[model samples]
Target: MGKNDFLTPKAIANRIKAKGLQKLRWYCQMCQKQCRDENGFKCHCMSESHQRQMEVFGQNPNRIIDGYSEEFEQNFLELMKRSHRFSRVAATVVYNEFINDRHHVHMNSTQWATLTEFVKYLGRTGKCKVEETPKGWFITYIDRDSETLFKERQKNKRIKADLAEEEKQEREIRKQIERAEQLLPPEQNRESEVEDSAARELKLESGVKVGFALGNSAKLASKEKTEAAKLVFEEPESDRGMKRKADGGGSKSALEELMREEEKKKEKINRKDYWLCEGIVVKVMSKALAEKGYYKQKGVVRKVIEKYVGEIEMLDSKHVLRIDQQELETVIPQIGSLVRIVNGAYRGSNARLLAVDTDKFCAKVQIEKGVYDGRVLKAVEYEDICKIVQ
Candidate 1:
């Protein structure tokens, strides 16, 4: 049949059926209408009300598109906020859930071209937290519903308050129990004999006749005096000197000498002629001379000596280089040395070294910005340095 001939009953019906969305594809955002079949949708589209709506849309196409976009954004955000708020979820998961609603606004109609763009937009607008990683972008919906967030906060506060009150009550109960224990008779008796004696004396003065055993008291006093006298007389002066002489024997003297020699050896082991400075390596002259084992080479390596500042002296089969005290100050980068900042919040700011204050443990750097040239910074450790340009 010709194209005009296809406008007949069966042909038109089939074309309408093919052009219409399936039952699953039907969506309605406002009245939330979803028609399963082509006939129903075609009937609705031909109705007077649907034509009136189309006329309104035709008046301002951009406004209708914007309205749909806004509706779509709102619905999607509501779903995310309610379901996955405060949780890092894949953008696709959220999008899939959003599309489950028939009549949901299509993402193609929105301003964002992709999910990543939408997530970034949300982050920029402070509507959600978005983080980008090697795997993919993650998003956590920001819940701005005041009542819900306030209720959650109130619940947490109440829990904290209850815990604090419970702890306080526990502490109070513990104190009460401790006070009751302190007041118990057996514990009081174990405290002091003087307190018991005082109580006894008070009872006696109150006309209560309590008999005291004087014989036992006299025996205890006599025994204490005897022990004191023994302690005062037992130590003799002559025995102390003899004990000292016995302890200071020939073997003990030898052991002391050996200890002194060991201490000297430790001191020799600890002593090093060359020391490493910051970012500078120290190489020993003896290591260079020791190439021919016992033959004892003499001359200092001029190439190695040029790298360091020192006076080389050949002393008793060894080359000794005395590093100048000024060399420590000289090797360090002076003011105006070009350097880069490698770490911390102010990273990537290139500047000239203003000063090095070892006492303060800081390096003063001067950074120029346009015509101002006023910014300065203090860097403190190795992590703060990138490299010395010069």
Candidate 2:
């Protein structure tokens, strides 16, 4: 009907020409035009519309280029997130898929000279995990979405609960210790110390091995006779009640046994049967998998199936495996990470890691939850704690 109508040959041809990707060098970023050939691009540069755009770009070349660069980066990453999320993909592969849009901001207009440089930039800024292999560069997206943040906050909430619990335990322990101290008063302690010093304390120099001689029977009998002459069953200057109080049925020692019994009771009650939580790193301990060579390998807990089962995604191989929690041991992260005490007097308690002793294969941690918060365990072995995957 009309010369430039949608049905017209000219209009159809224009659509066909713009259907797929063209040479990037022939595209003008400022004019937002794609020329089919060098001759067409050269001619378009001489046109009035092109001349106007060039003049505008000339006014602030750096600002215009920067704007294009930012847009390009944003669009590229958006495509990456939408398409290759949770997968390791080659830089060129993603770039190839990106160019199929026909209207993507060309790399020529961006600050980066090549795709490799752009991939390296992503790695440096920690936006993506980048690696260069013999095959070329590959990237995996790092998720820092609100969902992840929500999980971390939930984890922090759990830690706070742990801190409160630990604090209570500490208070109880302190109270018991105080009660024991009260039972053993200063005066009784001094008397016990004096008696102990007389019996056991020796003012011997270091490395001096003193020996005693065995005299004849006659001298031993004479010494025994003198000791028997001084033997008396009479009470001391103190009253009989005080004497009875001095040896009062292992008073301090009995209190210590009471404390130990209380701790054992706590250990039985607080130690949970379920320690499997979502989003934690754990090791495969099932001997059944040893045949498949997965034993002792680490994985991330994607989901907790039941209280005792987890859907784990292996770290090295990226394979998802359904494993029982009993067959999985939790992993320990770096210092300052929240860890659960798997076994110990503090079993099933959550704690914050304080320091590591690599040579001893042990870690120092402070209990962070229920009754033990602020209590520091200085030499917990590596096997006794596993990191919380927040």
Please, what is the TM-score per model?
Answer: 0.31, 0.46
lDDT of each residue in 277-302, candidate 2, tens digit only? 66668999866578888999999888
User: Distance (Å) between predicted and true CA of 27, model 1?
Assistant: 3.9
Alpha carbon lDDT of each predicted model:
0.50, 0.70
In model 1, state the lDDT of residue 196. 34
Off by over 4 Å in 1: 1-32, 35-48, 101-117, 131-137, 142-390
Model 2's alpha-carbon lDDT is 0.70
Deviation from native of the Cα of residue 45 in model 2, angstroms: 2.9
Span of 10 residues, lowest total lDDT, candidate 1: 199-208
Pairs clashing within candidate 1: 27-103, 28-103
Most accurate candidate by TM-score: 2
Q: Return the lDDT, model 2, position 100.
A: 82
- How much does candidate 2 score in TM-score? 0.46
